[model samples]
Target: MDRTTHTPTTDQSRPLPHVVVVGGGIAGLAAAARLRGVVGGGARARVTVLEASPRFGGKLMSGEVGGVGVDLGAESVLARRPEAITLAQAVGLADALQPPTTAKASIWTRGALRPMPTGHLMGVPGDLDALAASGVVSPEGLARAAEDATLPRTEVGADVAVGEYVAARLGREIVDRLVEPLLGGVYAGHADAISLAAAVPQLLAIAQRERSVIEGVHAALATAAQNPNPAPVFTGIDGGIGRLPGAVADACRAAGAELRTDTPVASLRRTAESWTVTTEGGEELAADAVVLAVPATVAARLLAELAPGAAAELGGIEYAGMALVTLAYHRAELGPLPGSGFLAPPVDGRAIKASTFSSNKWGWLDKAAPESFVLRTSLGRQAEEAVLDLDDAELVARSRADLREAAGITATPYATAVTRWHAGLPQYPVGHPERVARVESALAALPGLALCGAAYHGVGIPACIADGWRAATAVTAGEVSPDLVSGTK
Candidate 1:
């Protein structure tokens, strides 16, 4: 349906339901798009998005490094989940989706670069032979991992730490050199603190059903192999993953949704029949529903008056700060880039947590700037914030040192850019699943108010999209109503 802007007038005869989605990130954009589909273009509903930042897209941003387009934040979407792909297709970005050029990655550990073991689920090796051949683990570590099959079943309660469980079954080497880096890449968290149920639910489920962790991994792998046509693990946009938000925002506007950037919401209030959203500039909007698509802290503050319980739960969620240093070097200086890039386990005592050889990993980058080798190195993870305190120049220098030590590159970067994400990634501790459930249940009591974002569910692009879709569905369907009133407000 084609959307057209309608002037707001004091005409009660034709009042249409209004939806105000706070935060113009991917989740808010997706929610606005889904709302348009639900309400259609004629006169079903009016949607307005308020973004605090000057630009939209949230973390999915891009910039030029060495005069070449590169993603400054999130770069890829997990293809296994259909939400992101579906949204992209809906927003006329179907043709722009591209898979990574190379999936091969290595782990820098034990003073050497080692091939990541195959047949593993998040570094939990399913094939002992593969793990042994990769030399990622010492002979003693390999033997310990193999013992999982014959060892007694581990008693896992409602939830367990991914690192604790894996280390008990395998060994510290697996947790340090393998699992830690892989999980760190995703959560920017330590495996010992991340919840098995929240971070790797599938593996957790398998472990619960099987006696051995390795056996569970093997079973999971077997199930995956049975699929005839598995989608590529990840997909990116042709220009950059950053292009996604622009497309989504355009789709929303085209569908008649009003999008305003740099408009931070100050407060939210509920009445007997409608909700009131106040912007920082003191403008008030009356809406039939509201979607709190902001970060945990922002969402908590907004929901405090509406749902104190949910607000408290959201406040408990912790976040990790990180910085990415993007550098461009002459291809001749770093002859023949190695496979995609390498990850550094904290055990390696490296300043950077992971590095992505952007030129080698993405075909578009390679084609865009063949003469320049573009790469990005990530610094700081979880509690490692001291490194992020350094100046941009120092951060770049440290990242360069890490790349040189890990990959044997001595070339000076022709250009460099630093992106810092403070409290960017949310940490899912052992009871994260339960906390999320509690937050959801508490919010369910307050109708017309729904929360969605990376903090509540899976952190991937697809998961956030799915969360947006769900929030849109709930608000549009009237499952959540603006009519409900709690004693708090």
Candidate 2:
């Protein structure tokens, strides 16, 4: 049976150019969707999405626990970015769009759950008063932070690690207690290893021109503060972000694109006029253009024979793995919890990195199960994979222990789930920008070829979507130009 859905009517007499997208992840789906949209609803080209896995969505996935559906992967997207939300709306999820609750988060630092400080950029506090009041750092650490304004001009040559630069400016205490947890939440990598330029470009740009990071943060945030009507920080689907990939795939199918799963491309061979994509099962598909929307390693292996330069660069990209442990408890037993959740700083020597009150953060979850409460804890980090190796029972026990200590929740969960993602998040190391540029340079000569994923730009949903559109545009230009994809401009 054909898995494709809602096939739109197309002229059968005309032979449309074929465009093969390698990957069934969100990025690849976005690419196929954009390609179909640009090709006059598949009238100009036949778009086919091929995936190795049986399922789509990549890290965006949903699972059920205790009679309640929960997000087993990413929960939300940056609402300020137009790409994700726009794509969601474009794919008929406009009515399902929902913002998270207004409840603030806390930082588990200095041996307790402290209020998360405002007036900061990625945990680098701009307002010393706010940082002090929040107690994310000690008095001595706060004193050291003040020295950034008086310190000599620090040079961030080309690029640097976020931890290195921030520690040099403020203090290691801030990096360990504050910055690490925040960056871990996003990148799942160590602050000392993650790239400042690639991970936090705005912070890098500020540190480049300004002498004091503090002053630069103020100047950077001033633009947003000046705006009276600021957008919500994030948005989620009524179900979960996992629904996005299916919706996009449905839209692509409706646009007359072929969607396939469990078929991996083994090699990419370039023909004189087109490309030949050989699958693992030895079946072949010809395409005028190809978008390599898979992870770096898989992409490297597939492109080794065709584009060795790109393969070489992509092979070096590292990825971080993590496990999400979701536990469900009776609402009466779990008791009331403050805030959405708290980020656990590694410096505190905690077993779990962070925990989210899924029932509190997403009002949908609360409304879905008024009598049940659900939450999740993240384990493992870049260069710290031992925790991910733990058994599900052990993982759940550690998470429960942490909850008992921090939030004082001693209730046993009625249901539990453990989702492990090995090599899940791509790490952006120092010189990541240069590495990505080199990859682009290598692919420039290879016409009708494109790359898009968390490896190139960002790990967020919006960035991946933007890169997907960029890949589509790169293959065929002026077709899907939009404000969200202006980065490629």
Candidate 3:
């Protein structure tokens, strides 16, 4: 069926199924889009997305600085994962998708900016020689990392923290210098606590197979190298990844999905006939099915009365806040910086967790503002809320100070912007996968219900889109199925 023109089914005896998506973020929008694709218009079901915020695109936001378009939140989506890419194409972004101009990055460790080492999976170097050449890991650290080959098999029983497991095999240096920074860049959480099973399951699988992680990494890398077809690891729209949410929302609307912003869902009541979502404005919308795509805390509150067990599971999930200090300097003052950006290991005690040289990373951003150079530095991580609490000027000052130390970038930016995300990124501590499973299991009792977000599954664009698809499948299939929400891709 042409979803854009889909009308209600011919059976007048049955009214159209209504799915209320209680969030307008990428996950919610993706869910709406999926529902439309599956049942166009109301042929199968009609979707209504209610967002508490005034705008959509929860974390994937596009903004302007120095008269140039740039991403204020997430910069890119994993193109290798078909969900995000496929959704982008479905929403008419096939031609708009663009890969990064440069993948080269740096790791700021041991008081210097070193080239991000190659032959690695999520910063766990498969080749020690390449790792040593990058100088990211110290000589002593390299020796300890090399010990992984000779070390006895380390048991990764059910699940273990990524840092704890890797450090036990390699040394703490590799975990602190390499893995921590990489994981931090992704989750804004500490590697020592982040779950290997939930965050990097591939690494966990490798740990389980090979007696040594290094050997496992080598085999994985070798297999990847032999593959005839490989996809870009990441992708973004020409304007910025921020354009994705707007485009997705447009597509959902075009498909006859109602997307309402600033419409907060106050409570959800389950009747024998249907699920009734009450808005804070006192408007009650009856939904044949519902997808809880909001934040954990919000979802917990909404599910408190309906599915208390699922709400209890959600209550255990926590979030981390951070700030993005975006700076735009005159091209005359600064030529393209060395690499795309650098990840600052928390061990370095730096104010900024990571930095992205926007102009150098994306061809479109570079071309969009030929006269200006753009870059952004992120600060704060899980339990590091004090840094993000600093005033905007102080945050900018701190970011500049770090840039000066790492990249020798001292020229004051002509334009600057600070974007703060309070309780933004969800932390995936050990046993998070089990927790997600329990949540899903509990939701199985509530018919015509599903939950999805960065909280349960992986926290990325592609993962969120996949979660949305899972929720759509569950609710559309006419059951409360949390089992479908498992797996990232």
TM-scores, each model vs. reference? 0.94, 0.95, 0.95
lDDT of 3 by residue, 1-489 (tens): 111223475687875688889999999888888787732223357788999999999999988988888999999988777777777877888999999985599998888889998899887989999998999988899999989988989877879999998889899999898998999999999998999988888898998888989889988999988868888889888999889889999988887788889989899999997888889988888788999999999999998887888888898899999999999999999744798999999998998989999888999988889889999999998899888779999999999999999999979899999999999999999999888898888888888999888888879988998788778878988432342233453
Candidate 2 Cα errors over 4 Å, as ranges: 1-15, 38-44
Model 1 lDDT tens row, 87-206: 888788889999998558988887877888889999999999999888888899988888898988888888999999999998899999999999999999999999998888888887
Residue 397, candidate 2: how far off, in angstroms?
0.7
- Report lDDT per candidate: 0.85, 0.87, 0.86
Poorest 10 consecutive residues by lDDT, candidate 1: 480-489
Q: After best superposition, candidate 3 residue 266: deviation in angstroms?
A: 0.6
Of the two candidates 1 and 3, the one with more favorable lDDT, higher being better, is 3
TM-score of candidate 1 relative to the true fold = 0.94
Clashes per candidate, residues 3 or more apart or on different chains:
3, 0, 0
For 63-145, candidate 2 gives per-residue lDDT tens digits of 89999999999999999888888789889999999999998899876678999999989998888999999988899999999
Q: List the residue pairs that clash in candidate 2.
A: none
